[model samples]
Target: MIEAVSLTKRYGNTVAVDNLSFSVKPGKVTGFLGPNGAGKSTTMRMALGLDNPTSGQIRIDGKIYQDLKYPLRKVGALVDPRWVHPNRSARAHLAWMARSNRIQAKRIDEVLDAVGLTAVAGKRVGGFSLGMSQRLGIASALLGDPEILMFDEPVNGLDPEGILWIRNLMHRLADEGRTVFVSSHLLSEMALTASELVVIGRGKLISQSTTDEFVARASDDAVRVRSPHLQRLRGALTDAGATVHEVDDAIIVSGMDSANIGETAAAHNVVLHELSPQQGSLEQAFMQITGDSVQYHSDLDEAPGQVLASGTN
Candidate 1:
């Protein structure tokens, strides 16, 4: 497991991470989520000992990263896919890393094949496409077959197929009792890929829980009801202590489930055309939770004409 206790980082007057603490357990994928400049990268950097924390500590298992005998063999990370020698071939790059860490040279071929970069193993990294570069980075990270993996924006330049492949690979790693901690801006993909989530904003910890529990906490159990007798149904629902609102000719009932709404309508002799529960999506839940913490806010007050004029300018 990876654990952080009172973890904090400061760059002069600015605090990049503030009193953050969380644990990432093995046998499951934990998603690291936050808006831009929310200290996620800084936290990950501290975890790998790339940057020192201003106070507090982060540990892998029971020891700090520097205490490990062979750090790469215990933890593998792909923080920046582009952090490679431009002229070196994919194979050469991994070979050097494996050599420095005293890893077996044969393991290079295994990881290259695992990441689907075997065919381009000899190609210079400078000439590789973004997707290929990502694969190469992943290959290097897996060179030691580490028990813990950390990936930052792993799907940044991946195509749909590449994205799906990485998602499955993370799951497969966790299934083998490995710790998978990844950060991504793609909430939809995170929703499907991550079993647990650690959310932060403005350098402070906001939430850390199972994905389902976090989403459920922020979602409202609303029921959508549409009926020819809209007036009667609305009155009956409101009388039953449910909040009702009309939108696009449909009544949305909150604080009540679909079954209760349907039963109430039936007893009141109100005919319903539709009655369905509307569950909040992960994106919606994230937005609601992190709404106030967003550092950059876009101006939505501009008129269409103003937007067009500004674009031309």
Candidate 2:
């Protein structure tokens, strides 16, 4: 397991990571989430000992990363895929990392094949595409055959097939009782990949819980109702203090439950055709929970034509 206790980092007058604390347990994929410039990269770098924490510490298992006997053999990470020497072949890069950690040279081939880079193992990393470079980085992370793996944007340049491959690989590793922690901007993919989430904003811990719980807590309970007596039902729902939104042939009701909405319709003598509860998605939950936490806000409220017309003057 990976644990952090009051981890903090600073750069001159700027604070990159605050007194944050969280734990990632074994046998589960924990997603690290935050808006842009939220100190996620700094936190991950601190965990790997690449950046010194201003105060407190982050640990792999029970020991600091620098104190590990063979850090690579215990915790594997792919924070920056391009950290490799561009002049070296993919095979050579993995071989060098393996030697540093006393890993067997033959393990290089195994990981290369595991990441689907066996065919291009001899190619210079400088000429490889971003997707291929990502694969090589993944291969390097697996070179040590570590018990814990951490990846930052592992699927950044991957195609659909590659994305699915990495997703399944993380699951397989976690199933084997290894700790898997990853960070990504692909909220949809994270929803499908991570069973648990550690969300942060402005260098502080926002939430740490199972994926289902986080979504449920941030999302409101809403029901979509369709009735033949749409006008009467709308009035009745509004009178009952339910916020309603009309979309085509249906009305979305919030601040009330499905059973109560059905009862309200019945009491109003409204004939209902459909009544379905809407489940909140990960994207919706993230936006709602982290709305205020975003460091930069984009104003897309103005229509394109309106903005163009205003600019013409």
Candidate 3:
């Protein structure tokens, strides 16, 4: 298991992460999600002891990462794929890492096969494509079969096939009872792959919940109603104690469900044109949770169709 308590980080005048705290347990894939520059990378770095925290603490298996007897043997990480030397072959790199803490060299081939890089083990890393390089990085991390594995954007440069491979690898590791912690900015992609999520924004903790709970918490719980007699529907809904928002000519009622809305309209002798429920999407829930705190570019990215519909409303 991985635990972080009140984890904090600062960069001179700017605070990159503020009192952030969360735990990652084994047996499931936990996704670390945030907008760009929201400090996800900074938090991961602190957890791995690559950067000192301004305050608070992070530990792996009840001990500080640096205090672990064999760092890579207990915790393995792929922070940046570019950390590999371009001139060295994949096998050579793992060989040196093995020698760093007296790990057995024979295990090198085991990891190489685990990540499917055994076929190209003799080739210089400089000639490997981005996806192949990612595999090599993962192979290096698994050399020791560490209990805790952290991946930072493992599928950033992968093709669809490579993406699926990485996805399967994460689950396979978690299935073996290893703690798998991964970070990514792609909500749509992570939504389909992760079982749990920890979301951060503006260097602060926004939410920590299972994927289903997060989606449920983000749901509006409002009912959608459309009618040709829009003005009458609004008046009736207001009189019936339902808060209403006008969507173009349609009325969106929050306090009442479809059945109640239909009955109320019928009692009032008003005709209905259409009454449809708009089921919220994971992307919608994410936008609602983060709101304006999203640090990355593109306002349209969160929910493009909603934006267009908003204008019509």
The estimated TM-scores of all candidates read: 0.92, 0.95, 0.82
Best by TM-score: 2
Clashing residue pairs, backbone N/CA/C < 3 A, model 3: 248-313
Task: For candidate 3, write residues 88-168 as lDDT tens digits.
Answer: 999999999999967999999999988888889999999988888888889878888899999999887889888888889
Q: Per-residue lDDT of 1-313 in model 1, one digit per residue for the tens? A: 8999999999999888999999999999999999878899999999999999999999999788989988889999998898999999999999999988899999999999898988888988999888888998898778889999999999988999999999999999999999999999999999999999999998899999999988999989888888999999898889999999999989889999998998998999988898987878789999999988777554547654343222110
RMSD of each: 3.4, 3.8, 5.9
Note the Cα lDDT for every prediction shown: 0.91, 0.92, 0.86
Model 3: residue 218 alpha-carbon error in angstroms: 1.5
Top-lDDT structure, candidate number: 2
Q: Which stretches of candidate 2 lie over 4 Å from their true place?
A: 302-313
Relative to the true structure, candidate 2 reaches a TM of 0.95
Compared with the true structure, model 3 gives a TM-score of: 0.82
Indicate the residue-level lDDT of 62 in model 3: 86
Per-residue lDDT of candidate 2, residues 110-176 (tens digit): 9999999999989899999989989988998888989999999999899999999999999999999
